[model samples]
Target: MPDSTAPLLLKGYAWLPDLRRRAHDVPAVPVRLLGKRGTALHGKEAVDFFYDEKHVRRHDAMPGPVLDTLFGRGAVHTLDGEAHRARKALFLDTLKDPARVAALARKAQEEWDRAEADWRGRDRVVLFHESARVLTRAVHDWAGVPLPADEEEATARDLVAMVDGFATVGPRHVRARLARKRQEGRLARLIGELRSAGLPPEPEHATIARAVAAHVDADGRRLDPHTAAVELLNVLRPTVAVSWFLTFSAHALHRWPEHRALLAADERHAWGFAQEVRRFYPFAPFTGGLAATDTEWGGVTIPEGSLVLLDLYGHDHDPDLWPDPYSFDPARFTREGVVIGRDDLVPQGGGDPAAGHRCPGEDITLALLAALVPRLARLPHEVPDQDLSIPLSRVPTLPRSGYVMERVRAEAPAPVG
Candidate 1:
């Protein structure tokens, strides 16, 4: 625990001692950078720096990190200008309507309903992995692929491992690569089927895998299949990467029970909790980069090619940006839940620090969580190890057994006079 003193950024304070302090000076404020080797960024200042386009270009350039090694540098996340827009455009047709999202949500709800029914009156059942299993199947179904019932967790783990993008230290890097391989194998088979179908070459085909396949050099040609394989992996990579946040949001509401009741009883609270959870439990700690050119930040000059990381967790907890930063008050989001159209509180880790990024999928995550978290809370059950301590490091993690939740049999409400 390095000092969180004046003008200093600590290595990782995911368990904030003074969330108020974070809400006070975050994002834009310069904190002292603790010199920890092979550490990921974990401060609001880092978030701001990460959001900067110039800084994003820098993040796009750095090597030895997670996503870069998977796709070599400059996939959609790294590319810029027309090239960026063009590549990104490939997914437009596939993602155009919200119908797919709605159907997926409905599928998820049915599963949650089933989980609650199965766990009624139980002590606790591990839910983190279970929920992952549920949502992964929903997304897999949307992708027009068959997701075997038992393999959902393994597939979800593989997806989470790939998007974790934490290569370079610990077993995290090794695990991520292994997960990538597992996922690549699964996606390869699916792609083969798509190829055999000979469907129209639209953006639907240009799913993340398709986009990677279609990504040509400046000359507008196709990339090798190996490169395309990584892109296919990318399609669902971040989906699971962000799932933990939704899972944590569900855990927070359940562990706190008050939020559960509040959300269930009030439409306003439901919407507000939706926003706060994303702010409070974002999965990505920060994005990484090396400056392309000299840049100015927090009154300090960053020399060309210095490593920069944008910590999304820190930004959500900014003391100045958010009142009682650590407190889980959802009122700040307003009724109907504030749509996250590039505000200061960015959890998806893109856009300008004060502006926005390419986090188009945020709505999808939020909508699903908004629907699911409240329902999961009403399950009338309790998880035994609700107090299982998660680390406050570069990224938050859960134990292998995963989280448990028991169904609490809801007593019939008395009739009101």
Candidate 2:
């Protein structure tokens, strides 16, 4: 075990890459004990901490941006342990079976069709942030009613601005608080509209919305519209952020004509490919889990009540687990490679994590991606830089100057077949 007194580096998830640690570093996950935080932060070293009870119990110990002063405490992330688990479970119930995924895919196709038509025979279209806005509309539409374009656009803009502040990772994020306050005013106006308009019919469309409509807590009361609005806005962060993943993956296949063949060779191929794309280009490489109780893990001790960040990107790319840490390997998910999760093991809060706060939109994202990847491929087009790896700096970059390529229009339907 390393000495407990060793000077510990407190690099948030942002600095993981600079440290040169990948998925397979240290024989197992590192459970760095900062002084007295040994027993409280258990599972930091578990071969699979995703499912470890100790890990789940250390909820508040994880790091996260504080909520706005106006809202106080609302969502599961703001609450710890039992309260979080209970609330999260209720929200998760809506995604237990994600049939809405297909609808969202169809919706995505419709939006793309519209966008393409608007291209007006232009060979390329610059798209990055626009793709996310498109998905937001789909998600919102799936929940019940199509959002007014203006409202949807406003929310998407606010979400991006707020998150930009968090990514700053320090005093800068604090500076962003004022901007966040102003944005909240706009959000309040939107919520007022939703409340007066009534919730829509898309039950499984989004967990928070669905829960607000269907859930009855121990008190047997559903969420008020204001609380519902806060939760709803929170969901947008991951959903739209995922837009980057979808765009990056599309960017990869479009650039590398060979990948189009790979995508075509098998229809069932996209799921695994998508997973790898997520792992390969993890937008948010790491997240923190605070130690609620003192815990000992991986032969190291972490004192109680300490903040610990997990280097998901580092661990995913660790040399021990990945032969070439920097190389992009989509098939790493095969039975041989490390699978971060299973039904029994759940460490992370988002998708693949335990039942507690799994990303409800996992299916929504997959289905939308599945349709988009194949459709773009089946059609004909070529764009320069289609194969270029996403640059290190484009937090979520895609071909914005437009995909410079010609379309291979689909052949007219055969006379009989």
What TM-score, over all chains together, does every model reach?
A: 0.77, 0.73
Q: Per-residue lDDT of 1-417 in model 1, one digit per residue for the tens?
A: 353422222334443324325555332323233332122344545555555666545434545454533443345566655565565554443443477566666876886677566567556666766666666766776655567878877887777665554533557677777776677666666666655565456644433444444445554865445455555555465555546766677657655767867877876676578778778764555555555567666544555655555556666776657868878877778845444445467766655421334565666676677778777666555556555565555444543335665556763464799
Which portions of model 2 show Cα errors greater than 4 Å? 1-14, 17-24, 27-73, 120-124, 169-210, 218-221, 323-325, 331-354, 379-417
Prediction 1 global C-alpha lDDT: 0.57
Q: How many backbone clashes does candidate 2 have?
A: 36
List, residue by residue over 1-417, the lDDT tens digit for candidate 2: 342222232343334454334433343234344443322111234324523446534444433354552122365555555555655665465433455456667877887676556554665644555666776676666554346776776655555555545544455466446545654454446556655666556544443445454444444566564555566555555555556666667666654557666677777566656766666554554445555557655555555565454445555555555567566555565445556443211112333433444555566556777777765665554455544444344322333542444453442443685
How far off is residue 119 in model 1, in Å?
Answer: 4.6
Per-candidate clash tally: 32, 36
How displaced is residue 393 in candidate 2, in Å? 6.3
Per-candidate local distance difference test: 0.57, 0.52
